[model samples]
Target: MDSSIITIFLPIALAIVMAGLGLELTPNDFKRVSKHPKAVLLALFCQLVILTSIAFVICKVLTLPPLLAVGLMLLAASPGGPTANLFSYLYKGDIALNITLTAVNSIIAAFTLPLIVNFAIQHFMNDGQHVGLQFSKVIQVFLIIIIPVCLGMLVRYFRPELADKLNKPVRIFAVVFLIIIIIGAVAKERSNIMQYIGDVGAATVLFCICSLVIGYFVPRLFGISSTQARACAFEIGIHNSTLAMTIALTVMASTTIAMPAAVYSIFMYIFAAIFGTLLNRYAPSVQPSIEQAPN
Candidate 1:
């Protein structure tokens, strides 16, 4: 809410959260993509292309306001968070695939997010109202998203024991930070919060359901294994709302633009759990296989 918090603490918090992600990763995670090239590529297509296009269509169909439309696009562009792995593990999805996808998606998003956000800004916001992701801001986004993760990976490489020790605390702080950001964003728009939810609630809900369905079914259509399809579902469905919200508030400096993500955060977990449960219940059975560590 405060300028100081937006300018300083938000980025610092995001960096710590991303570094926590890095603690769980290594070069091997990225390399593992080669083992399941089809699954990985299909998942990427769903995340970067199909889901983003779906979000655009929804924004157009729903006629969301300019800022909120951009917010939805930003959320669509965000990579899946660590929670997707937990869901994958819980629901018998390929946890290894989840980890690999998260690792790769985080890396890819640094480039794609700026392009999508800039396009959304130019397309949605008119000349006087535009908030472009200029060079400096794009660098800020890159530093916030990429550098901290690299530093954390370096920490893991040099002092794994310490990295292990810091892992849980950083995760706890990440959740806390997400809660604070969502609360702050909502509070800033308290008077209009109800209206905001009324405006975007259905769009977000539909988008979430479409994401999960598309993420799973599209891969399955291509003959991917059920477990890997499940992994794709959560990977595409559970977005990094924290990242979207932070960029909206800090980089874009618009709480209105943060509303979609904040509201989506409220509904994402609930919908993801329900979708996972239904999938486990109705989807054809698969033999239980030993979970392999990512190579």
Candidate 2:
């Protein structure tokens, strides 16, 4: 990618996409955490603790190249994308739960993303301290997520009709942007793209499978309803790779560390769809949806 594109344009484009996510959120989405404490807490634990630890073990066991390992870890650290709600709706999952999770996770990620990436750098990359998350970079990560999201929420709260109008287009743009980011990152590493995929592909695929499986079953084991469990599966399975890639290219300034997210984006939708199919087939016997999807 061109330096201007990566440095100047990427963040702006990503913020627009993120603001689109914000358009769908409201203050109530955050407050819903209290209403469904068990489900919400379980999902967050899987995202921050279980999935992250699994990613680390995969990196260590695979002995991926340092930057590649960090890339994988970054993907794991990322929160679920807005697409999760769409998939949740399609699969008869609790779209309201998905939206609530997205609302909360987006906020939590501001703090956790930098910490996880810094750890990956320190553990995987030897000169981690030099390229690590500094105070300014952490603030960049914070604002990049927080500001646009809050702005979008304000739009939703204040100008709801306009927010509703923006929602579909922005969501479309977000999907398109994900494709562009993957292509740009891959083109940047054209010569090594094949090797990079070979190294990280299995790890990404395994991570996706684990994410979908654990996302569903862990909730099931806790006796959460199947509808809600399906929501958990998709939310945990589909990551916001665009955010990961944006942080990598602009904030971390390393396309090498962006490779895992790039490759994972390719497999993510495929696996997510397949997992959705299986969930649909063996869905809960008598799950009734009382929650409506967000606009």
lDDT string for model 2 (1-295, tens) is 9999998889999999889999999998888887677778888999999999999999999989998898899999999999999899888888888998999999999999999988888888876435668889999999999999999999999999999999998988888888898898898899999999999999999999999999999988998888888888999999999999999999989898899999888898899999888877867425654253211
**In candidate 2, which residue ranges exceed 4 Å CA deviation?**
128-130, 290-295
Candidate 2 whole-model C-alpha lDDT, 0 to 1: 0.89
lDDT of 2 at 79: 95
Pairs with backbone N, CA or C atoms under 3 Å apart (clashes), candidate 1: none
Local distance difference test, candidate 1: 0.90
- Tell me the whole-model lDDT of each prediction, alpha carbons only: 0.90, 0.89
Q: State candidate 2's TM-score.
A: 0.96
- Model 1 ranges with Cα > 4 A deviation: 284-295
